[model samples]
Target: MTSQAITPSHGLYREALPKGCIVFSSSEGRAIFREALEAGHMRCYFKMAEQFSTQTELTFCGLTTLVMILNALKVDPGKTWKKPWRWYDDNMLYNCVSMPMIKEIGISFDQFVSLVMLNSLIIKSERVDELASIETFRDHVTRLSRQDDHFIALSYSRKSLGQTGDGHFSPVGGYHPDRDLVLVMDTARFKYPPHWVPLTAIWEAMKPVDETTGKSFQTEIRIKRTQYFK
Candidate 1:
């Protein structure tokens, strides 16, 4: 687990966003969510394993995002579960079920809230329509990230984010008001590195229906209690 700073590069943008990327001013990203970017939160890691033994090199974006957010909030599942990430991922796989059904699908927004509730953490979440304007989405994320004890997780489309996937999940460490960009701490470190992306791109990605529930993905805000584990 390590913390690495990322600088904007033309090659990265060209590869990720061939259609052209939005560039924000330096001052725009200054007021980042410091707590979320702390070394502890940024370094938390999880990988999906096969049969709880061998590494499968599979995707567990939603579970990894949840672990990242919980770590950011200082909530240690390790206090309760021996192997926290794997435990949580297995729970999601078994608990999250839709009528149509897909095996080992990502957890939904509601399931995410339920999991946090089970941990006794204070949580508030809302669905962000994919069709909503970029400004509206930006305002929601900015306002939430600015609050003390608040950290955000989003489920969005990788295609919209210049990646090769349908949907993905990650924690939003900060928002750049001036540039309309958000600092996404991508949990799929095996594939994507942390980076700044346009709020609009995220909005478009989040609009699609999650195959598991037939509902649009969501942005969630979780508040940690100071004495939660006491």
Candidate 2:
């Protein structure tokens, strides 16, 4: 589910860390980060951390993740953000669709990939629904996280992760092979922190169907690079 921020005044929603997860800001999360770094599994985490940004809108999680990957890869936005600096902004992520539409409906996995590609980033995507086995999903996340030029990101159901929203997107910071957990740098910084999650649980999280597109939450392991396609 969503890490939907709860208001102390409303008392209608609350954020809870169910078993099988730990936020990065916590002591347990700190240990996981320390160990992952010592093991050389955090090659891309540093770069991604340089570009971390929170989602401006509740449904802007996909776009929020998109800009992080883009800037982390150092892709030129082809337009100036301030006066002379070229950059990627959440508002600048509407080449494939209108920002108003995306703001209203968010984006599907396919739409996310399309937006990434349209902005000149090259990504290698895997269809989670068509994945042959959970082991392969584990392998993809494991292998990608070790490389310095690649980072893993995916969209999965909140319910599967024992959260309360809908589908969400975030980058996988690192993996602890021994503990079999993956780091999820959540875009909803207000709701959740960068958290470590069991690998199998993350795979299961992506298996749920998205009713909007009538497809599974198709996830991807992407290469971070700026490409000028001919």
Candidate 3:
């Protein structure tokens, strides 16, 4: 999601009930709200905007920070805690995001994660060659293809996945059909962090046929985040 300018009507006042009453009515609350909003909790940003009722107070610096944070929240399945932390545990929402138009902001990771999370596909990059047994991972994707209904792979690095234990995980790009298990290895081990991650699903693309007209229209798929990962 991309970040966009938010008006008082759209930010705090947009809510049905009074917001930031506890956080912005007093001088101290206002200070806390300012800090929290800059900290980039999606809700806090909107609440601050709501409290001030003026978008002008939101400087470009604050807006940019919020945009990056919100954009990160939209993508990054691992950030959302969709990655398997263990065999038995269930998936959890990664971070909270409240900014409108936050999705429109261009984020490399968001773009990558969105395709995977929304498509029920796991993307692996060729740049993962730094890992000792990356071929095993590639083999895993290929094997998954046998069962996946739809999948995609790219040859270049749109972005790096950071470094892993062995070397930097260069982005190559590959996806699995209907699976959240991405097998690419990175030098950097991105673990579960405290935040919210939107649960995008591929089922949204499903459509049904119209019996009378003999035609079909796209159906909206709205599966809760926990359903697929759990």
Where does model 3 exceed 4 Å of error?
1-106, 118-129, 150-152, 158-230
Best by lDDT: 2
lDDT of 3 by residue, 1-230 (tens): 99999656542222221221121235644444344334332232232122221112121112222222223223233333334531111112122223332232322333334433542333333222233243444344344323222222221121121111111111111232232222221111122111110111111111222232333211111112222411
User: Candidate 2 at residue 11, lDDT?
Assistant: 40
Model 1 residue 199 lDDT score: 77
The lowest-lDDT stretch of 10 consecutive residues in candidate 3 is 192-201
Candidate 2 lDDT tens digits, 1-230: 77987558754433767788897889888988899888878887888899999999988999999889888877888888998888988988887788889889998888888887787667877767553578877777778778857767888898898887878999888888889989888999887778889988988888888889888876655756745211
Model 1 stretches astray by more than 4 angstroms? 1-57, 76-103, 130-136, 220-230
lDDT of 1 by residue, 1-230 (tens): 99999987754332343242322223323333333344233221121111112112234565566654554455545443454342333333333454233224555677666766765477766566634565656666767555545566777767665677676767766665655666766665545555667777777777777776788767544445454421
Better of 1 and 2 by TM-score: 2
Superposition TM-score, candidate 3 onto the true structure:
0.20
- When sorted by TM-score, best at the front, the candidate numbers are 2, 1, 3
Q: What TM-score would candidate 2 get against the native? A: 0.90
Q: Alpha-carbon error at 158 in model 3, in Å?
A: 8.9
